[model samples]
Structure formats: C-alpha cells, structure tokens
Target: MNRETLVNALLILGLLAAPFAADAMGEPFYVTLATRIAILALAATGLNIALGLGGLVSFGHAAFFGIGGYAAGILATHAFNAEPLLFGLPGTNQMVSIWLAAVAAAGMAALLIGLISLRTSGVYFIMITLAFAQMIYYFAISWPAYGGEDGLSIYVRNAFPGTNTMRPMSFFLIAAGLLLAGLAFFALLRNSRFGAALQAGRQNEIRLAAVGIAPFRIRLVAFVLSAMMTGVAGALFADLNRFVSPSMLSWHMSGELIVLIILGGVGRLAGPLAGAIVYVLFEFALGGVTEHWQLFLGLVLLCVVLFARGGVVGLLAGRARHG
Candidate 1:
C-alpha cells in the first residue's frame, strides 16, 4: 500500500488499540474519550458528504444531530416509564430500533429543510440552514415536555443485541464499527457514478444539468443521507453521555462538525477520523493548561486554514496525484 493508505490503516488500528490498552491499564476514561472521537468522526463524515462532495455547505446539521439525540432520549424515556409514544407506538431501549428512529427523524427533517433551503444558493443557503437550526434549538429549549433547557436524561444506556453496551470497551467497539462503516460508505460514494455527478455539480451545476443530471435532486438526496448518518452518531452520542439536550442542536455544534471536516481534509475519505483525533487531543491537552484554551484552538485552526490547506490528512498524505 502507498503512504496514504498505510496511514489510514494505521489510524484506524491505533484508535482501536488505544482504547484496549487504556482499558487494560485501568484507565476507562480514556476509552470513553476514544468513543467520543469515533462518534464525532462519524458525525463529521456525514457533513463531508454534503460539504466535501456536493458543495452544499449546510450550516444547520446540528438540527439533525439534535434530532437523533432526542430520538434516543425520548424513546428511552418512554421505555423506562413504560409509556407509549405517539400513535400508540410503544417505546424501546433497543439500540437498533433507536438508530432507525434517529435516521428516520433526521432524514425527514433534512428533507423539509432541504426542500426550502436548497432553493437558494451561496450565502442565502448558509443563512437559511443556520436559521433552521436556531429555530430547532429554540424549540427544544422551550418545549417543556422533555425537560426543556435542562435536557432529558437516560437513566440507563440503551441495549445492543449480543453485547453488553454498559462496558466502555463494548460501547467503544460499537462506535468504532459504525465509524468504519461510515468511512467505507464515504469511500464507496466517492468512487461511484453518483459521486462523480455530485462532484461535477459542485464544480459546475450548469454543466451537470446540461448532461441531464438534476443537481437539485442529487444534492437533496445527499443532504438527507448525510443527515441520517449524523443522526446515528447523535444517537450514539446521547447514549454515550446518557443525556440529550438542545445544546446538541446549536449552531456551534454545526460549525464544529464543519471544522472537523476541514481540519481533517475536506474531501479526503479518512479526513473526519483524522480531524477528530487531532481535535480531541487538542481539547484534552490544552484544557488542562488553561480555561481559555479555545483561543489557542482558534489559533491552531487559523494556521491549518492558512498553511495546511489540505488538513492533517492532506499534509501527511501529500497532494493527490492527478494523471
């Protein structure tokens, strides 16, 4: 394998090994840290599909992320209380079921948001998406049914078939598996005909339209799919913290997802994972030194944007060799 592929493999293996080693060394908190990286990477991967591939710089992805968290929280709450959800549907603490609900809820929200937001482009699109996210964030805060600003808490972690998710290692593995799956999906999409069309639309929508491709439809589908993936991450995230809140839907969360993608390598398949690793490391290492560590973080991000245009992955992998 070439350097890029080797680096990618090593990154995944390192992530896997680090947690196991941490667990063996009696540092379960590190395992949780690794799990957070996996979940955040997965969420950023979803954003990459739209921002990296389709050139859709959506600024409201937190809406979907929050939706996923709420889906898990609401479902688990009802299950814990032995209550039925809307339409007489019973609640479940099953991870599989909760994931499905998260996907569906986020997908529907993306569809509605995209239907209107996609009608515009450039700054308009960005602002519209951000507006939608803010609306959802406010609604979540005002909605008193689910604890409002205080957020909803899950007393126990959700169950996964054939696995004791309560164990940090087990949960980390689950998150890792999903992260790998998302990476694989991203790679496949980046190479497929649809992927080509999506990129072409990004480069020149008029040309793609001349070739009989509907950029609108392609982007809309991509947006919904992206939301679904991020939603799954949100569900996993809620389970990780055993809580759900409006904070998940905030514009800041959306911006962070975009920052992860950019920091990793905007269009690179493994960018999200790489970025998450760097981001979490920065947060952990810097937070211990100063409370205003974000100022330093911002400086680092500025350096990345100004000099390391391709992100950490791009820098390590070198520029893509085009024939």
Candidate 2:
C-alpha cells in the first residue's frame, strides 16, 4: 500500500482501539476524550466537504450544527415528559428519528441559504454566511419556547436500537461507526464526476463555465450536503453534552469550524480529522493548566496560521503527492 493508504489504515485502527485501550488502562477520561475528538472530527469533516472540496468557505455551518442540536434536545425533552409535538405527533427519543430530523432541518436551511449566497463569491460569500449564522444565533437567544438562551437538558440520552448507549465505550463505537460512514461518503464524493466538476469550479470558475458546467448549482449541492453532515454531528454533540443551547449557533462556533479545517490542512481528506484531534487535545490539556485556556488557544492558532500551512497531517505526511 501507498503512504496515504497506510496512514488511513493506522487512523482507523487507532480509533477502533482507543476505547478498549482506555478501558484496559482504567482511564475512562481518555476514552471520553477520544470520543469527543471523533465527534468534533465528524463535524469538521462536514465543513471540509464545502470548504475543502468545493472551495466554498462557508462561515455559517454552525447554524445547521445548532439546528441539529436543537432537534435532538426538543424531541428528547418532549419524550421525557410524555408530550406530543405539533400535529399531535408523539415526540421520540430514538436516535434514528433524531438523525432524520437533523438532516432535514439542515438540508432545508442550506437550500434556502445557498439560493441567495450562491449569487456572491469571495469576501461577500464569507460575510453573507456569517451574517446568516448570526441571525440564527440571535433568534435562538430571543426565542424562549425551548429554553432559549438558557438551553434545555436531555435528562436521559436518546436511545439507539439494541445497544446500551449510556456506556461511554458503547456510544464511542456508535460515533466511530458514523464517522467511518461519513468518511466513506467523503471519499466517494471526492472520486465522482461531480466532485471533479466541483473541484474544477473551485480552481477556476470561468474555465468550468466555459466547459458548460454551472458553478452555482454544483456549489449549492455541495453546501447542502455539508450542512447535513454538520447537522448530524450537532445531534451527536448534544447527546454528548446532554444539553442544547444558542451557543452552538453562534458566530464563534462557525469560526472554530473554519479554524479546525485550516489548522488540519485544507483540502486534504484527513485535515479536519487531524485538526479536531489536535484541537480537542489542546482544549483538554490547556484547560487543566490554566483557567484562560482560550487565550492560549488563540495564540496557538495565530502561530499555526503564520508558521504552519499544512497542520498536523501536513507535518506528519509531508506534502500530498496524490491528487
């Protein structure tokens, strides 16, 4: 196998072994840490679809991410209290239902946002997306129906079929499975004809259009898919934290998503995954060392932006030789 293949294999094996290793070592905290990294990586992977593949630098993905968290929170809350949703639909705590809701909500939101945002490019595109996310963030804060700024708690994590999800290791496996499926989709998309067109548009929109391809349509499709994936991650994040709040939709959250992509190595398949691991590790480590951990994170990010272009993957693998 080539270097990339070997790296992918090692990554998969490491993630698979992490929970068992932690359990055997009597260090449940590291298991939880690994789980958080996987989930964050999954979310960053979604952003990578648009930014890395399609070259659409969206600063509003946290809008969809928050939407997914809210979906899980709302349903779980009603189900916990034996309440019914609008139209008399009984609320459910089932994981499948939450996933569906997360995808649909994000897709619809993306459809609407993409329609308008596709008209612009460069700085306008970035600012427009950021504005939209901020709008959602403020809406969440102002609207008090589902606890609004206060947020809502999931007293019990929503259920999955045939598994004791409450167990950290068991839930970690479920998250790992979802992440692998997402990675498969990413690989498939990157190899498809449409992916080729999207990348072409990213590199040169005029040239792509000269070849009879519409950049707007391709990007919009990519944007929607990216949002859907981020939304799925948001749902998992809500379960992990046992709460959902407007903070998830904030502009800062969107910035962090972008930071993860850039920090890992833009356009590389493993960029976001590696970045998330580093980011979570930094957060965990820095939090233990200082109360103002974010200050240190900002400094580290500044250093990365100035000195390191390829992030951890770039540092480890050198330049990518493959297309």
Candidate 3:
C-alpha cells in the first residue's frame, strides 16, 4: 500500500489502541484524553471539508460546536428534572436523541449563517463568521435560564443502545467510531464529483460559474454538513466534560479548531487526528509545568507552517495523492 494509505490505517488503529491500552493499564484518565483527541479530530475533520476541500475558511465554526453542546446539556437537564422541553416535547436522556437534536440544531444554525455569510469572501467571510460566533457566545452568557456564564451540567451521561456509556472504554469506542466515520466520509467526498466541483470553485470561481455550477450552493451544503459533524463532536465533548458553557462558542474555541486543521495538515483525511493527537498530548505533557504552554505550542505551529506545509500527516506520508 501507498504511504498515505498506510499512515491513514495506522492512525485509526493507533487511536483505538491507545484507549484500550490506557484502560488496561488502569489509567482511565488517559482514555479520556484519547477520547478528547478523537472528538477534536472529528470536529477539525468537519472544518477540513469546508476549509481544505472547499477553501471556505470559516472562523465561526465554534458556534455550531457550542450549539451541539447546549443541545445535549438542555435535553439531559430537562430529562433529569422530569420536565418537558418547549412545545410539550419530552426531554430525552438517550444519546441517540441528543445526537439527533445536536445535528438538527447545528444544521439549522449553519443554514441561517451560511445563507448570509456565504455571500461574502476572504476576510469579510472570516469576520462575519467570527461575529456570528461572538454574538452566540454573548447570548449564551446572558441567557441566565441555563445558568448563564456558569454553564449547564449533565447530571448523568446519556444512554446509548446496549452500551454502558459511563464506562470510559465504551464512550471512547463511540467517539472513535464517529471519528472513523468522519474520516471515511472525508475520503469519499474528496473523490466524488461534488468534491471535484467544490475544489474547482476554490481554484477558480469564475470558471466554475462558467461551467454552470453555483459555487455558493455547494459551499453552503458543505458548510452545513461540516457543522453537523462538528455538532456531533460537541455533543460527545459535552458528555465527556459533563458540562456546556459559553466558552464552547467563544472565538478562541473557533481559533483552536482552525489551529487543529493547520497542525494536522489541512485537507488530508487523517490530518485532524494527527493534529489532535499531537495537540492533546502536548497539552497533557506540558500543561502542568507552565500556564504559558501555548507559547511553546505557537512555536511548534510556526515550524509546521514554515517547514511542513502539508501538516503532521504530510510530513510522514510525503504528500497527498487525490486519487
């Protein structure tokens, strides 16, 4: 097999392996960290679809991410309190329901945001997206009904079919499975006709337009799809932490997701996983020593940008072959 393909295979296997090893070693904390890497990788993978494949650099993706978190938090809270949600809808503590709600909420928000923001390009696009995210962040902070700045907490981990989600191993498997699915989707999308048009529009919008394809629609769809994936990750993330807060919607969160894409290798399918693995491990390894660990991380990012433009996976796999 080719290097890129082999690297992709090993990355997936390694992600699952680490969690299993951690569980075996009685280091459940490490399993949680591995799960965090998988969730962040999934979130960044969503962003890569728009940023890497479509060249749509979104600076406000955290809006969708936060929305997903809130979806889980709200549903679980209501279920725990034995209260019905709006419109007399019953609250659910099931992961299946929470995930569906997260996807729906993020998808709707993405649609509305894309309708307006996709009209602009370049810095305007980035700023508008960032502005939307900040607006959401402020809204969450002011909405005291859900504890405002204190955030909402999930009293219990949501249930999944026949799985004990409270177990670190089980939860890690769910996150890793989703991460794998996201990667598979990325591989398929990158090879499809739609993906070709999306990439073409990124290269030359005028030519793409001349070919009777509307770049805006394709981008909008991609943005919404991307949001859905990230939303799911957010739901999983909230469950992992057992809380949802405005911080998830903050511009800093958006920036971090972008940083992950850059660190991993942008468009490469396994790049987000590689980036997440490195980023999380670095944080775990150095966070206790200094509060300014980010400074060091920034230097590493500079090296990646200057020396390894394709990202971590790119460094190991040579270069992407879009076949």
Highest lDDT model number: 1
lDDT of 2 by residue, 231-308 (tens): 999999999888999999998889999988888888777788778877888899898898798898788778878888
Model 3 alpha-carbon miss at residue 240, Å:
0.3
Candidate 3 — worst ten consecutive residues by lDDT sum? 314-323
lDDT of 3: 0.92
Between 2 and 3, whose lDDT is larger? 3
Point out where model 2 deviates above 4 Å: 321-323
Model 3, 1-323: lDDT tens digits are 89998998998899889878889889999999999999999999999999999999999999999999999999999999989899999889999889999999999999999999999999999999999989999999999989799999998899999989999999999998889888899889988998999888888999999999999999999999999999999999999999999999999989999999899898889888998998998898889899888999999999999999999999999987765
lDDT of candidate 2 at residue 198, scale 0 to 100? 85
On TM-score, who's better, 1 or 2?
Answer: 1
Q: Candidate 3's error at 53, in angstroms?
A: 0.5
Better of 1 and 3 by lDDT: 1
lDDT (CA) per prediction: 0.94, 0.88, 0.92
Show model 1 residue runs off by greater than 4 Å. 321-323
lDDT per residue for candidate 1 within 138-160, as digits (tens), equals 99999999989999999999999
In angstroms, give how far residue 39 of model 1 lies from its true place.
Answer: 0.1
TM-score, ranked from best to worst: 3, 1, 2
